[model samples]
Target chain A: MNFNATLIGQMIAFVVFVWFCMKYVWPPMMKALDERKKTIADGLAAAERGQREHELAEERARESLVEAKQQAQEIISRAEKRAAEIVEEAKADARTEGERMIAAARNELDQELNRVKEELRGQVVSIAVAGAEKVLEREVNEQTHNELLTKLAAQI
Target chain B: MASDTLTSGEYIKHHLTNLTFGQHPDGSWGFAHTGEEAAQMGFWAIHVDSMFWSVLLGFILFYIFRKAAKNAHAGVPGGLQNFCEWIVDFINDTVRGSFSGRNPLIAPLAFTIFGWIFLMNFMDLIAVDLLPWLAQLFGQHVLGVDPHHVYFKVVPTTDPNITFGLALGVFILMLYYSIKMKGVGGFFGELAFQPFPKWMFPINLILEGVALIAKPVSLALRLFGNMYAGETIFILIALMYSAGIVMAGFGGLLQLGWAIFHILIITLQAFIFMTLTVVYLDMAHQEHH
Candidate 1:
């Protein structure tokens, strides 16, 4: 228990141990701790970045979906409008053909009626000539008779 | 003194004395034959047991920590690594809490002080008779020496020399950091200046110098007093147990209870010693305007 040379010996031991611990023990352990801290921080940062990128990707996907739907609607509407225009043109073509056919039929009917009237006039003129011949029982002047017949034909 | 001849008081006295080796009063160099002889040998004598046990524990601490350091990794730690890291983290926290400066030595110093002193103090937990009895047996059988002449004091921290030695080391570091942080002029000025005032320089010097010197003294005495008292109690219990079978049973129970309580004392003493060292060094590093 006396204060003695053990003090010096223990002091030397303490100093040497401190030096050993400083050189060997402390730095690596602290470095490991710091490394673990930095790694955790970096991992957290990376996770956050991944989450943000995922959200951006989702947003882009949604935007493209909306744009695609709009394009599809435009294509459908354009097709519908073209079909309507085609139907209108087909109707106008059918109407013009029907009017031309009706006009030709009417002209043919008028020509047929004029032809029938002329045939009826020819029959009547023949019958009247026969009767006159039977009544007179003699020949008449030919040039004057022919002239009267032509005039009769023009009237009919 | 032979075991059969010793009174309870003499027994306790025997347990309390160190195995001192130094110059004898007859002006020869040798081991002190008795406690009175050790004390009479004066300042130059070394406590062989204290030096041996303390150095052995210090080396053991160094070896274990060095092994742990060699195998240390940044990955998940296993058992030895985990324990080592926990100790490192604990010391680091203590230093960070107390020390504001960036010196690298403080953390490791705290670690060594805590671990080495704890091991030294832990020596007291061994049955008081166990080690000395073994040494006596070895001395008698192996060395062809008288068992009565063989003395072994296992608890190093119980010795004033060792405790004071540790405190002295801290004191040196304190002075070193004081000069390093504040410069030589500032350190001397601090020692000579206002706890009173600059005009009362002489008075301040006396007051502050006493306070400065008191730091290591208190550090040493606190650990020494606690450990020595605990060791004395254990020795008393051992003496009681040696009295008779009935007294032995009662003493055994008391010994168990005291040993359990002493664990806390030993650990706390180690903690206090380490903490004060850190605080003292931190105080030294502080730049007082």
Candidate 2:
């Protein structure tokens, strides 16, 4: 076949165009796609990491809450025990004070009763002596008076 | 115009020709004419019948698939589903056998190309004279373009420009895979060190470069030559009968047999083109020989 220059030029141009497409166009486009794939993967990984951190933080919060709850329970139990002790101490103090006040009142009443008994014994003896003096013009013997005084002391 | 002087066959032959540019006798760029012209666009040429038919068929297939998918069943498929699945499977298998790299794009592209080219090649089964004659009926009796001057070649693959253009597209794709698989430096190094030991780098480089050029040339020529030859034989056989020769009956029989034989040729040529495309892409995807 007789080759024409135009055909040769076209063939050349075709070769050049093929080369250009291979060299310039294809590589970059494929690379861009690969990069896009990698970007998506990385984004997913980052998202996963974020999710994991959030979960971890939540877990820690839950743990802290449990720890705080335990601590709060302990404090409440200790406070209750202390309150019980304070109530017991107050009750004991009130009981002791009441017993002391009753003992003091009994001692005061015993002293007053003793003084009244002595006054009454003295008055009875004086009244007996005045009666004997009016009844008897003459003086009585000491032995008879002693016997009556003893009997009166015994009776009082 | 002088076009009125030519027969239908000769008129058809002329339009089937190429418009050449550059290389004048005076040694400056001048215009000339060759039977091979680029399809009228930057990337597409006018000579390609396969491209046109393929695109049309692709759209048709796309519409059918969309409809089938829309009315799809979770149970056994309907008639359309079976047909669509069969084609999809065929295309997938072709891609699987041909391509090496895991490209989500190449499989569909190959399917589209295969379907389109097959449809275009199927156009050859139509009577060679049927469409052109029909056009003449409309032109001479109706629109009046002069039946004697009405010219059209319905078979696009019969045009060298079209076949060559398709081959060139495959060649471009091959180069793309090569570069993508291997970086620029790696790709150049491959050519520089191919088919020989590193000790023979200089000779290897030259040989490799020639081999690279030969790839597209052979690819284009093989397809163009087959389609062109098939069309020419059919036309010649038709002419023999139309000439009212003694061998007219024999010519008709021979033409019939040839047309039957040509079914294989057209199909084979399309398959070869597609197969080679896949092979080239596979080779490009390879990092080593």
Candidate 3:
């Protein structure tokens, strides 16, 4: 094999060129690719995060709606309870007023009966005095007639 | 009178010469002289033609790639961007797939190697005598250099040294990746213990040794043989025209067909080189043999 200066020079040039290209050119190219991959991955991650957040918000909204519905049901039931209470209070008041009216009527009847009884007594006594005058066909003493009329009135 | 009365062999040999200045006394190899070296003086000159065009083609491709990258799209690509994206994806999927380990440097190195060698191989499609003839005219008439001494060879692929040099670079890279991955001790241990126990170290060492040296040799010879054969055919056909063949039209058509066929050769050679490089690198990264 011939080994000359030119051959040596060619060998050196080849080694140098290959080494330089491998060191400088190849690295940046690979780095650019890695960066591109990272960018794509980041984009996907952001998209996934956004989707998760949206889903969470939707779930929260659904829960709030359910809670609102439950609250509305509770309020309606509370109003119903209030209405029933008002009805019950009205019924109790009506019962109390009826009993008071019945008592007043009873008292009024007793007073009327007493007045009627007193008038009747007065009439019976007059009648009895007239009867005694007739029976004797002549005048009698006042004390005797008065006593008879009182006894007749008591019996009636 | 002698100049005008030159035989066909002398003409062909004259045209076969390179744009070199100095000649070795033995007529095989020498350092290049400034202006008087024989056209085919040294092994290096054998590829001087290819070197010039290959570098030029590489720069042009680099420029194109840079421009595409500068204007790259994050979305739908168009024009050069589309082509570049396809090429990048192809290298990743194909070359990267062939290798065992994911090398960060291998892909781009493969790309440059493929493009450079393929471009050099493409020079084989040019008529074997075209560039030398052109060089002869320029050297004798324009540059005032003797046409005989003006040496240049446009096809670098036909030179074994250039291919071997390139293959050697890949070999060195393979070694580096192996060492880096396995450490020096581990690398040697692999050589001594691969495919058997430590007692069979001699056999393992021999196998590993053969495998290591064969890498560059196979790579160089594969490329050199293909391109040399292709150039030989072109030269023989060229001889037809110079032999006073009256049917130049038929010869021209045949040349065109051969050039078209050579395109496949060029592309295949480039692919093979890149794929092999990736495979070798992949092997280097493996912890086992």
My TM-score estimates for the predictions, one after another, are: 0.76, 0.54, 0.63
Global lDDT scores for all candidate models: 0.88, 0.63, 0.70
Better of 2 and 3 by DockQ: 3
lDDT of 2 at B149: 46
Question: Which should have the higher DockQ, number 1 or number 3?
Answer: 1
Candidate 2 per-residue lDDT, tens place, A1-156, comes to 122332333334334433433344334333444455577889899999999999999999999999999999999999999999999999999999999999999999988898888788777766665667668965656477888776876576
- Location of the lowest summed lDDT over 10 successive residues in candidate 3 chain B: B31-40
TM-score of chain B of 3: 0.85
Give model 1's docking category.
Answer: medium
- Displacement of residue B199 (Cα, Å) in model 3 is 3.4
Off by over 4 Å in 2: A1-156, B1-74, B141-143, B245-248
Kindly list the per-residue Cα lDDT of model 1 for residues B145-256, writing each as its tens digit. Answer: 8766677899999998899999999999899889998999999999898777789999999989999999999999999999999998999888876677899899999999
lDDT tens digits by residue: candidate 3, A1-156: 111223333345455544544565445444455566778899999999999999999999999999999999999999999999999998988888888888888888888887788788878666666676788776666676667667778877
How well is each residue in B1-289 modelled by candidate 2, as lDDT tens digits?
Answer: 1134667567447445433343444455422333322222222223222334434544564566555545544345578865755665666678788776797656555554555456566666677677767755886789765565444456655555555655666677778888888988888889988688888889988998888778878877887687777776776666665555666788878888998998898888777777777777788889984
Sorted on lDDT, best first, the list reads 1, 3, 2
Error of 1 at B27 (Å): 3.7
